[model samples]
Target: MIKDSPNPPEHLFAVRPNLDTETLLVNASQDLASISDIAVHLAFEVDGAQRNVALGICRMLEGVQLLVNKALDEAYPAT
Candidate 1:
């Protein structure tokens, strides 16, 4: 009878790059831009204000909104 041969152990992983921070941050933003926010995705699809891409957009929009608000306020001040 032939002797049973032992199987080799599988490789294990310990340390790995920040898949989220490094990949997600950059990718998430790109993904958000090319495609609509409504599209399905693996990463967390939070609101713009809550997300980096959305937050970035919000910042720019906020500036424009502020200017408009300011102009409107100046044109028609409260009596």
Candidate 2:
């Protein structure tokens, strides 16, 4: 889990070693952090854990896209 994470994700998910454990950990951590910031009630749990940080992130992203679309629509106002 993230408890074992050493370095952040960007440093690992780049073109080099080709998808290592560290990369996954880093991505997961970032996703969780992002999700936590925007979400209120986290629904899904990853790996049967209490707080599935990764899944929470996915849910948050969905919300973010919706919010972005709403903003776009308001700004455009259907011409």
Candidate 3:
């Protein structure tokens, strides 16, 4: 008989030194915004505690995204 695996293997992530930090921050903010948007949509589909939890998560992500955007702005501001 074959044995079943209970846990998944860990992934090894590569470090990229050449990528721009400002660009990465912008991309991260965009991705998190998308996630938060999805949570907002899901919030409407669920009810009670689950809906509240989703909305709470969405708020937190929005806050983080705002901070990231601020950081990017500070790093590369318009003249």
Arranged by TM-score, best first: 3, 1, 2
**Tens-digit lDDT track of model 3 for 1-79:** 9786688556557546798987788788889989998999999999999999999999899899989999989998977
Q: Candidate 1, 35: how far from true, in Å?
A: 17
Off by over 4 Å in 3: 1-11
Per-residue lDDT for 56 in model 1? 62
Model 3: how far residue 33 lies from native, Å = 0.9
Instruction: Locate the minimum summed-lDDT window of 10 residues in model 2.
Output: 38-47
Model 2 lDDT tens row, 1-79: 3486576576555555677654554555566556655443453422445356655665767666566555545545665
Per-residue lDDT tens digits of candidate 1, residues 1-79?
A: 9865597436555434665443433444455444433322312467554566655665555555565555545655668
lDDT of each: 0.50, 0.56, 0.88
> TM-scores, in order shown?
0.36, 0.34, 0.78
In model 1, state the lDDT of residue 35. 47
